[model samples]
Target: MKNFISVVVTLFAVSFAKAQIPAGYYDAATGLTGYSLKTKLKEIVTNGHQDKGYGGLWDAYKVGDLDKFYENDNTILDIYSEKPAGPDAYSYTPVTDQCGGTTPGSEGGCYNREHLFPQGFFSSASPMRNDYHHVMPTDNVVNGKRNNYPFGTVGTASWTSTNGSKLGVSSFPGFLGIVFEPIDEFKGDVARSLLYFITRYEDDLQTFNYSDVNNPQDGSKNRGFD
Candidate 1:
């Protein structure tokens, strides 16, 4: 899963970097390295970003969240239930399978927008709450199980999803709260998504929730675990 997931993420990253970037988008950072490159990237990522509002995420999924890599059926690519090498445990149609007021008691019932950064951290503020880069369509029940927990390796899972994602106490050092661990197939995607979120919102991260004592912030603007 690590090798395959890494390849997939690398391909996606390379493709987006090469094709989606507008001409001269990185012209300012040409020949930059180290802190110079980092500063330029933050400038590039933060500028011209628009807030689409929370409702727009549902519409965005029709084009952005389809299962094009696996199953190839154009269903929602739910990380919590997707089996990359075989048929999924279940599938969801774009609009028809979206969650309403009631959430499923189990997996495969309906899908909802999951904030990879956890919306509560920022109090569900605009732009961050609606960002397509981190907000993904996922099984409602599994998303509830994830709740606001940080991602980590689980020691003993209290609950497991159909695709083997776990919700349990953390094996990661420093932090000892229950954490959600996605299957290995999606770890790269999750990591890259979080990196993008932090870079794009670097200016605002200091204002986010920071009540956890174990996870300390760097003296610089970036958040980190000590």
Candidate 2:
């Protein structure tokens, strides 16, 4: 009985420690309750950008003009710049012609901007929309396969991107873990982006697939199980 009690206490302490958020990070305001938070997120996404071609979806992949997208994406770059490592740390140029021998317009290569936190799950708002933390260049078809599926680790992935940059797993032990390998230069940035998504969208988090009840503070929930 004494041994059991000790083990229980130890587990509780570990869980408590894991639940603590990092200092100086964003926390949902108590007053920003219910849909108010959602509204605020949307406002942040659409305020400055011209909506001429801005469809409701966060379709970075479908933007008709790359230059226009870059012009609008400046706001997102600003947000990313304020983080610990900052914007330049997370930015990268897609190998424009390097389709890995895959044909142009093919699903394999042809670089695209991918949303780490899928747009399909949320209404796709600003801050969320323009936030550079979760947005990055990736292959097209792989992005579709990922399509708002919760991140997780899988013993076997159902799909693999042509560039070998992204893949999807069938199952994981904890938190629907999705394993993402970014260019070595941006791994930290991707990790931070995931952390940011969990905290910023905590209320709507359950709306998307999640492996655990704990919020972003505990990386264990929605963590890379592998």
Candidate 3:
């Protein structure tokens, strides 16, 4: 019993240490926090300029020109390549027909960039906008199916995309299996992104959907679209 207890304690410590965030990963000086963060993001979308020639956040991230928060690398490609294996491995399938495609003359076959954090709610801010940590290339039709519905697990998908992605239900086994697809390498990144969003926008959290698992922190009291 004594040996077992000792091993358990050691394991717990190791897990906790692995999950700790490094200091300075999210400094405001990176020009992504406070008023500066807001100002630069506004410049990107003023006067419907974004809708004209703007290629969305993914295009901006590829060029490392998302407002002012530039990434040190092609973090999205790195994350996708390094994703985990087994049942948890990132699954890529054709999004359903309803979502459509972007490639010319291809009909609806290719995947489109997906924002794990939906663009509609954030007003498509640049800092969070082009972050590869949350952006995924998924089927465009499936994206349309998802629309702005809050994430959740269900027995059936209420809607299905052209390629096959569905918005009805999540198949994950977690307590609140709100299904989200993150590449294998970036599971930790997704978790951290959620933590950041919660902390930074703690005041507006309630406005968004809050599952027992997704938004576990309740100490702060602000809400966003749900």
Whole-model alpha-carbon lDDT for candidate 3? 0.41
Report every candidate's CA lDDT.
Answer: 0.78, 0.43, 0.41
Better of 1 and 2 by lDDT: 1
In angstroms, the error of model 2 at 150 is 2.1
lDDT of each residue in 60-149, candidate 2, tens digit only: 423422222333443222121222232222332333322345544545334455677766545565546555446765545555555565
Runs in model 2 with CA error above 4 Å? Answer: 1-109, 162-171, 174-187, 201-226
Question: Which residue segments of model 3 deviate by more than 4 Å?
Answer: 1-108, 159-165, 169-192, 200-226
Per-residue accuracy of model 1 over 1-226 as CA lDDT, tens digit each: 2353344335435636845777777688677554455556668877888788898999999998899888889999999999887788899999999999886787889999999888887788888999998999999999998888888899999999888999999998876888899999998778777766765776777787767532333424533222
Residue 98 displacement in candidate 2 (angstroms): 12
Of the candidates numbered 1 and 3, which has the greater lDDT value? 1
Top-down lDDT ranking? 1, 2, 3
* lDDT by residue for model 3 (1-226), tens: 3342333233323434655734742243343444344333233223233221224544544453211222323232223223233221222332222124344333234445666667565566555555543455544445555555444444565654322333545665644444434333445555544433443444454554344344333433422222
Q: Once model 2 is optimally superposed onto the true structure by TM-score, how far is the C-alpha of residue 223 displaced, in angstroms?
A: 13
lDDT of 3 at 87: 25
Cα deviation in Å at residue 197, candidate 2? 2.4
State the TM-score for model 1: 0.86
Indicate the TM-score of model 2: 0.41
